[model samples]
Target: MTKELLTGNTAVALGARLSGVEYVPAYPITPQTEIIERLSRWANEGAMDARVVTMESEHSMLTAAGAASVAGVRTFTATSSQGLLYGFEMLYNIAGWRAPLVLANVSRGVASPITLEPDHNDVLSARDSGFLQIHAETCQEALDSVIMAYRIAEDDKVRLPAMVNLDGFYLSYTREPVDVPEQERVAEFLPPYRPQSGYMSAKNPMSVAVVVLDGRAYSYFKYQMHLASTNALAVHEKVAGEFEKAFGRKYPAVEGYMLEDADYAIVITNSLTTTARAAVQEMRKEGKKAGLVRIRLVRPFPRQQVADMLAGKKGVAVFDQNISVGSGGILYPEILSALYHRSDRPKKVVSFIGGLGGKRVGHTEFRHMVAVTEGCVRDDSQLASVLLFTDSDWQAVKGMLRTAGKGEVSQ
Candidate 1:
């Protein structure tokens, strides 16, 4: 293995290359196009043994990817926010078809109000679409998760598609040191893709499209998909173990930092978790019993692990990067639900939404969250979702409103 400075996009490409991907069906989009560009260059130069096909649209790109995977070959593909939305329909198809392929999603904030920054909305939109999710907090995790995703997804007990997500501009473009494992070592960790039994091939030709005439039949298949997804939890733990033994890096479903004896906890995910980590350290130095829990494996949502981490805390704040519109932060209630049944559940649970459209989430916002959670716990009162909007953010918005000839709006 050799250490090299690499961007998250380049790391993903190297991971795919080292994993021996046989095909890549691609559609170019900001942040994500760099990954495909590198792969295409390598494939063209004969440096990587793979077929890189440029599809006309994200829809067709995913369709071709699923088709190739079902046809018994290792496949990969990537997309960003709008591009991922464009191909949303194929997400369910690929997962329902039980295609064991890998997709790298560079998370970008969605449209309606447009920006080229990072958020979890695009990927979270596919949460119930039957795809397993692995969120990365750094360029290194971005590379390692893609490699681990293949092993988890292709497991016989969990034959489902998996997505490896990283924040678009944050990790995607930022350069960092990465350990690129030797191909021989990687092969020992992840062998060639052996198509599952009944996969489409010349020697085992079979119909992949199955039609159900009754609701009962449909329910059975859907339940099987759920079971398969749940199976990924164990499969991920097993693969993560082997990965650690082989590479000396261990990734768990949920990672806790200084959480063992904390009085307060912050729950977050994706690249923003790095900033939260530093905030936790500062809080520790200030004599606050603060900690952080990062959700790494999002789907097959690691419920038991999360509950165990946040158990017995005095106050718990869930920081969500995406909002659910009328509801609130997407991850808030999910974490709440996870802890609801535990006897040692947190005394106070609060929600904070920030980092939308890749806006910077500094120590100020984290400190604010901690303060608010402390207040909520002291008063034993319920608090609605708090938006992490600062005075500067409001002033900028006011400027935009005035420029648009709109009357002043109250803060």
Candidate 2:
């Protein structure tokens, strides 16, 4: 193993290469382009033995990837924001086929008002799309997750596609020290792709992903998919254990920091969890009894682990980087549902939305979240979701409105 400073994109490319991937179907998009670019370069230089194909669109790219994986080849692909949405339709088709491919999604804010920054909306949008999700907070985790994703996806009990997500620009552009494992060791950990089912070959010709015309057949197949996805919970644990023995680092589904004896807990995900960890340390110095929980594995929700972590806290704050349009933050209600039936649930739980469009969420935002959570605990009252905006933020927007000749807008 060699430790070197590498960007998250490079790390992901290396991980894919180390997994002995045979095929990569790609289309260029901001942030995500670097990952495919690195892979293409390695393939061109003959450093990696793989077929790298540049497709016309994200849709075509995913279709090609699915076809390769179903043909008993180890396949990989990547995309971001609009690109992810563009190929959204094929996500279900691939999962239903039990293709067992890996997709690296560099999370970016979706377009409407348009921005090229990081956010969870694009990834969270696929929560119910039959793909298991593993989010990363650092360059090293980004690399490790990609490698582990392939193992989890290809397991016989959970033959489903997996999405490894990292925040765009944050981890994508930022450089960090990553321990790159030797190929010999990685090979010892991950074997080549020899699928046990849904493989199309001359020796074994089989028809797969067929349409079920009847409602009963459709329901049965759909429920089977859900069960397969649920089986990932155990599969992930097994892979994570093996990965740790092979690489000396293990990632849990729901990871807690200083949460054992805390009265207040902060729940977060993705790259922002790094900042929250530091904030938790500062809060600890001030004797605030604060703690943090970072949700690494997002699909199959990990509700049991989450509920177990926040069980007896005085108050809890769930921070979501994505909003659910007419509703509030996408993760808040889900977190609440996880804790609702617990015998020793938190005294109060609140939701805070921030970090949209790659907005910076730092110590100030962390303090505000803790304060709101404290208030909830003190008053024993339910509160609506709060958007993490400051006075300066509003003033800057006002300046833009004024420049556009709109006057006397409500604060």
Which candidate wins on lDDT? 1
The count of backbone overlaps in candidate 1 is 0
Q: lDDT for each of the candidates?
A: 0.93, 0.92
Clashing pairs in 2: none
User: Over the stretch 1-411, how does candidate 2's per-residue lDDT look in tens digits?
Assistant: 999999999999999999999899999999999999999999999999999999999999999998789889999999999999999999989988888999999999998889999999999999998999999999999999988998999988999999999999999989999999999998888888878764687777777756678689888878999999999999999999999888899799999999999999999999999999999999999999999999999997999999999999999999999999889999898899998999899998999999999999998799889999898788877789899988999999899888999975778
Cα RMSD for candidates in order: 1.4, 1.5
lDDT of model 1 at position 74: 96
Q: In candidate 2, how many Å is residue 369 off?
A: 0.5
**Model 1 agreement with the true structure over 90-145: per-residue lDDT tens digits:** 99999988999999999999997888899899999999999999999999999999
Q: What TM-score does candidate 2 reach?
A: 0.97
Quote the lDDT for 383 in model 1: 92
TM-score of 1: 0.97
